[model samples]
Target: MEIIGYARVSTREQNLDLQLDALKEAGCKLIFEEKVSGVKDRPELDKALSYLREGDTFVIWKLDRLGRSLKDLVYIVDCLQKRKIAFKSIVDGIDTNSALGRCQFGIFASLAEYEREIIVERTRAGLQAAKERGKLTGRPIGLSEDAKRKAIAAKRLYENRDYSIDEICRILHIGSKATLYRYLRYEKVRLMNRRNK
Candidate 1:
């Protein structure tokens, strides 16, 4: 079985010697190191995970070095378990090969789930409060005055038939044929409303 190590520092200015030395002392045959924020994508971390095989031990100097949050950490560890690869964190004293370590990870998984549920509950409560207050939520209903003027102009240009749909959009600085069509529809509805009145 191979023992592989992964080390990371948040910034290029930070030294990785501490983590690297710890991993080397722990007998990691192959080590991958990266200098990147935990919240950002780490190509070296991805490479290290891809390099790990069944019966391999994925070692890290500290738990935070592996993931940005508890949820992310649990997900990575869960994937490792499914792949039959062991995980070890030297400073955190976590070893997936041990029963206590597995139990600790299980607690982390549960806490992550609880946190997600709480967020959903709070969001629902907020939406309900807004509804009770009769405040409009989400996108506004009508176009601005500038858009209405554009719609009127688009309709006039369309009725004249002097310009192609592409030319009309270009003349009006509209982004797409779809946006031009929407403007045309809006003007048609406004005209119909006026005729009814």
Candidate 2:
């Protein structure tokens, strides 16, 4: 029954030394470490989970280091319980192999899932209400009037053959090559429509 540990830090600037030291102290022979945000999937976490056998124990320095959301934490722990692999959160004092830990965690997981559902329902209601009120949700307005004018300028600059696409983009303060190409296409279509008319 090996004790495998996983450690995570959200950004490149953060350090994992403290968590690593703790895991080493806790008798973790093998530890996985990664610098990744909890919101995004961590490849190292998957690797660590895969390394565990049915009887092996998975160790983490803290619960938050494992997951950003309570729902995520509960789901992961549930999976471990089903696999009969023990889980230990050193900071939270949770050990799934124990009867008390199992009972308390079940309650915690249910509460977390319940809260997640409530949050989802509220967000959906809010979006529906905004749509009814004719207020734009999701991504805000894309192209501005100034951007439209710049698109026109981009077309002219490209046809003139004096300035490069990069030069035109720099002149217009366009951020990406994709956006520049899109603007150029929009202008091309507009010019064609005008000629056809």
Candidate 3:
């Protein structure tokens, strides 16, 4: 049986040396390496999974390294078994060629599913609580006070007829039409207050 190893890291900054070394010691004939976020596209992983044939063994350093999500791990293992490919994890000491390994996987898969359900429940509860408190959770507004000030100054310059809008924007280093519109809104608010007074 051909032994193929797969090693993955979540970012370009992480080293694959340790996993690669372990796979090599485990006698893998070929090792596939990928530096990608596990939550997203995993083309290399998909290819490795597809390449498995009957009697072929897929090896990895650890189960967690294969995937962070339990569902994904279970799916991959299930596919390998369906194709009659053996699966092994060096650190977890799991070998699909044995009866005990199958039992262990069943238990681990159940626990993983339970953990995911709990995570979903907790996240929904937290979001509901935050909604009750009128708290917004997402990307914060990017404009800082200094940036807003520069936009306001640019608007004021144009309003006072001190400088053309283009010239003021050039001086303030704001190049986008959307940003100019924001400034215009700020100016309109001030203009309305002045008129009221």
Candidate 4:
């Protein structure tokens, strides 16, 4: 069985020496290193994953070196497991070859799920409280200020009867006749509201 290693640093200013040295000490036969942010594409990581084979172990200095978040870590580990490739994180003491290591990974996945659920629950509760207080709990119901301005101009042009619908749309920078009609409807409603008030 072979031990393959992958190391990464978020920027060129950071050194991969520590992770590289640790992977070498761990007897990694092939090591891939890169300096890239976790949020960006990691070509070296893709290469390392492709190089791993069944009965091989993929090693990293730490779990964070392999993935940007717990969900990402779980996904990579899951893929490795499906390919019969073991995983090891030196600093994190994670080794998927043993039962305890497997359990630890499972706990990480569970924690990720639990965290997501808690966030959703808290958001729902907060929205409900806002509604109870008679506050707007969602998106505002009206055209934006810029759209309202365009709607007013379109309405005035339409009432002048000198410009065709298409001409008015072109003059007002509106996209379509349908849009111009919608804007005209908005202006009509606004004027009706003002009259009633």
Candidate 5:
């Protein structure tokens, strides 16, 4: 039976040394390490799961190291159980291969799921409160009024035969084709409104 360990950190700046060392001391025969955010999909984690077989053991330093959500943890543990493989989280003292460990895992998994649901509910409440308060969040407009004015002038110059689109864009210092097209479309809509009036 192979003892496989997995260690992961959220970002490149975070270190995996401690987890790796602990897994090694725990007698993990092979260890997989990846620097990836738990918030994002982890390709290595999927691969590690795919590599498991009956009678093999999977180890992680902590429960959160495997996954943060209770649903995620339960899903993983359940998958391992189906394969008749064992799982252990060193810090959390969770082992899913044994009877007592199995009972504890169910409790831990339930708690984890509860915690995740609470977070989701709280986030929804916060967003609803923000909306009620009329507080706008997220990135500000990409183009300011002054930039719009410059874009309009440049587009007009191009349309009037005073300059080519490329020359006008270069003179205006607009960096992208998309920006130029946006300004052009804005001007077209303005002209259409004038015609309708």
Candidate 6:
């Protein structure tokens, strides 16, 4: 049976060298490495899971490296068990093929779910308190007040026919003509509606 290893780090700046070396020393025939946050989707991890087969072993350097939530980790282990594939976490000393390991996994999973629920509850309470205080929880993304002003300036410059679209982009530090056009389209709609009124 082949041994497949997976390793992950939360950020792109983080290194996977240590986990790679450990997995290699552990006799991993193939290893998948991903540089992304646990909350983000991992294409490499999906590929590794897809490559698994009966009698093959799945390995990881740590439990958290395998998945963000304990529930997700447990689900992965359960799938492996159903497939007759073994699972191991080198750092955590967890092996799903053993009785003791299975018991420990259940306990760990339950505690993790409990902790997650507590965090969710506290976050909701905090958001409610902030709302009561008339504070926004977070700022909106994309074009803001400053961007709208710049977009309006770009439209005015464009209508003057003195500068090309490219020149307008350069002047405003806009990324592309396409993005500027999107903003222009919105403004065009707003202008049309005002005239219709």
The TM-score leader among the candidates is 1
Candidate 2: Cα lDDT at 5: 97
Return the number of clashes found in candidate 4: 0
Question: Arrange candidates by lDDT, highest first: which order?
Answer: 1, 4, 2, 6, 3, 5
Q: TM-score winner between 3 and 5, please give it.
A: 3
Tell me the lDDT of model 1 at 24: 95
lDDT per residue (tens digit) for residues 7-71 in model 1: 99998788999999999999998999888655668899999999999999999999888888878
Candidate 5 accuracy as TM-score: 0.57
The whole-model lDDT of each prediction reads: 0.87, 0.85, 0.82, 0.87, 0.81, 0.83
Write down the TM-score for model 3: 0.58
- Pick the winner on TM-score between candidates 1 and 4: 1
Q: Is candidate 1 or candidate 3 better by TM-score?
A: 1
Alpha-carbon TM-score of each model against the true structure = 0.85, 0.62, 0.58, 0.77, 0.57, 0.57
Tens-digit lDDT string for candidate 6 (53-122): 9999999999889877777787788888889999999999988779998888779778877988999999
| lDDT (Cα) of model 6 | 0.83
Residue range 8-79, candidate 3, lDDT tens digits: 998788899999999999999898887865567888888888787899999999998887678888988988
Provide the lowest-lDDT 10-residue window in model 4: 188-197
Worst 10 residues of 6 by lDDT: 188-197
**Candidate 4, 21: how far from true, in Å?**
1.2
Q: What tens digits encode model 4's per-residue C-alpha lDDT throughout 72-164? A: 889899999999999999999999999999999999989888888999999999999999999996667889999999998888877776777
Q: What is the C-alpha lDDT profile of model 2 across 73-160, one tens digit per residue? A: 8888889889889999888888888998898799988899789899999999999999999999876555688879988888887677
lDDT of 5 at 26: 85
Error of 1 at 64 (Å): 1.7
Q: How does candidate 2 score on lDDT?
A: 0.85
lDDT of 5 by residue, 1-197 (tens): 89999999987788999999999998998888878755767877888888888999999999888876678888888889889999999998878877889999888778877888899999999988998999876656556797779767866776576565567678888887567767777666342222111
Regions more than 4 Å wrong, model 2: 124-197
lDDT over C-alpha atoms for residue 132 of model 5: 92
